[model samples]
Target: MTTALDTTDRRARQVRQALWIGFALQLAVALVPLIDLVTFDSITEHVRAAYPDWSADDVALDRNAITWSLVGIGALGCVGWLIALALAKRPTASRITVTALFALGLVTSLTLLSMGGEGYDLVVPLAHGLFTLLPLLAGLTAVVAVWQRRR
Candidate 1:
């Protein structure tokens, strides 16, 4: 017969598994920004198109800044995921951290999305915007998995 201990152990295993899956997804998403950095030359035209008034040197500087910003954001997100994973055995702490991270990700993504052609006058390439938002999936999964009630 299945005892409460057995059920709790199974649930803990499931939570850890879910945390690992979230970490994997987060790591994969983190690479997207690095890939963009590797192919920085290809994005120059898009940046130029967005800010036609900017000089060649200006464009280069802006592109570098944008790419690096995305990379930094991705790296920080990966770190947060790792922290959540590390705390997975402590379900309350893990859930709280994951939920907070998810909220932060949502806010960051939305802020980035709203930051173009208006007050900020910064136009990010479509790929960059998407890259910024991709971590939400990872964060969301972790949040849901950790917060799920024991069955």
Candidate 2:
């Protein structure tokens, strides 16, 4: 019953919704702790438990670094999300914003992977994986959706 125009409109709406959900989910992960019990205990607690050989002090130190890094990562994503939300109507800005997010995601992913368990089940490494991949995925999705919209 839908015309091509209707279908295209639907697709555009879906793309916007995807960006919104991605933005919200990412913002929650970066800005809030203890949501869905995804707190400091989420991954680090596991690593700390598995590595009794290290002091609680060692775990605490690493936790600080991870937390701050995630915060920075989250801030950049937030900016990109805002840009996408505001300028999705404008393909040029949307593309640039999404590209920035993708670059940031790439750097974060590689650095986290490199830092994983060089000395330690690498259990906490899971956090690094999540932190690395989530934004990367979101960014990639944003870029693709916007590019498609331009067509």
Candidate 3:
């Protein structure tokens, strides 16, 4: 039969597994921005199509800014995931940290997504925007797993 200690251990193991999965998801999403940075010509085309009136230099500047911003944000998210993983043994701390990070990530993604006129346009390519939002899935999973009740 299962005792309280057994349940606690099982939950901790579940939380650890979820944290690892979240880290993997965060890493994968982070790489998407790096890929975008490497193949930036596609980003330039998208930016030019979105803003036809912009000059070549303007397009280049905008593409660079968007790509770099995504890369930076992705890196930050990966770091946050690592921190959450480290705190997994401390259930309260881990849950709070993961939940806070998830909220911050969600806000940042929404803000990035609403970067154009009327606050409803994607500043980056649709794929980039979607990729940026992908880490939230990881964050959500981690948050849920960490906060699961002792049942």
Best by lDDT: 3
What ranges in model 2 sit over 4 Å off?
Answer: 1-12, 31-54, 116-124, 149-151
Deviation from native of the Cα of residue 5 in model 1, angstroms: 3.1
What TM-score does model 1 achieve against the real structure?
0.81
What is candidate 2's lDDT per residue for 1-151, written digit by digit as tens?
Answer: 7676776676566557767877876786576433323644654565466566778788767666656666666677677777677876665776676676667667766765655465554523565556546656656776677666422
- Write the candidate numbers in order of decreasing lDDT: 3, 1, 2
lDDT, candidate 1, 113-146, per-residue tens: 6677632345666656766666576566666667
Best-fitting candidate, scored by TM-score: 3
Q: What is the overall TM-score of model 2 with all chains considered together?
A: 0.65
**Local distance difference test scores for all models:** 0.70, 0.63, 0.77
Name every residue pair that clashes in candidate 3: none
lDDT of 2 at 111: 65
